[model samples]
Target: MNEFRIIEDLHRLQNQFASLWDPFVAAGGSVYPALNIHKGSDQVTITALVSGIDPDSLDITVSGNQLRLSGEVISGAPKSDLGANRVERFHGKFQRSLELPAEVDPEKTTAEFKNGILHLTLPIRESVKPRKIQVQSK
Candidate 1:
């Protein structure tokens, strides 16, 4: 009985902690457009899974070390006389911003959207790239 009580207390405490960290999960605001970032010595590449979004509606912004991706996910289902009985997919406007590992040159950045994926290749700023210095003999 004592062990069960302890387990119950721990579960309650975990719930409280989760609520404190992310109140949106309980509110049903799930994150969309998952991303993967890869950093190289001279450039950074970012790939985002944006399946249901229109390419024309997508916007990408880059400044220094910051990158912002914004777009809307539109449902293609035709309007039915009856309302949706079950809807599991997300459909709405979404904006997500990420900080790059290194400063990137916005002017040189390239973006491509193909087959529901957005690929970005940002070149690292020349000023921010590491340079090797040689030790001069006195």
Candidate 2:
């Protein structure tokens, strides 16, 4: 193959690999802790799995329709007498941000940490919530 043809073929292979990996990252594979978002009539609930992390180390914030979650997982140093054969769990700082589907009231938002799960409840704006309309005879 000509020099230009070789480069073009390499670029095409790179594109194919990127396309295969993009879907996994887009589906929340990159985030440290997986998240589940539930949209209700009046509120939105976000749940994250943060097992083995200290509650005090977690930080949750909401800006407009975006929610940011950040925290650090500190692993204690192994004892001098013992040596670790294998390590699998992740340790260190991680942050994940998600854009909500609708506008929410940041002031009314509430969070709870229990059983290694962080749950955030964001109340939807009253103006954007579904409402019933009445019809009148002309």
Best candidate per lDDT, number? Answer: 1
Off by over 4 Å in 1: 1-30
- TM-score for each candidate, following the candidate numbering: 0.75, 0.72
lDDT of prediction 2 = 0.75
Segments in model 2 whose C-alpha atoms lie over 4 Å from true places? 1-24, 28-30, 76-84
At residue 49, what lDDT does model 2 achieve?
90
Candidate 2, residue 20: how far the Cα is off, in Å:
16
- Residue pairs in candidate 1 whose N, alpha carbon or C atoms collide under 3 angstroms: none
Per-model C-alpha lDDT, please?
A: 0.76, 0.75
Model 2 is weakest, by summed lDDT over 10 consecutive residues, at: 15-24
Residue pairs clashing in model 2 are: none
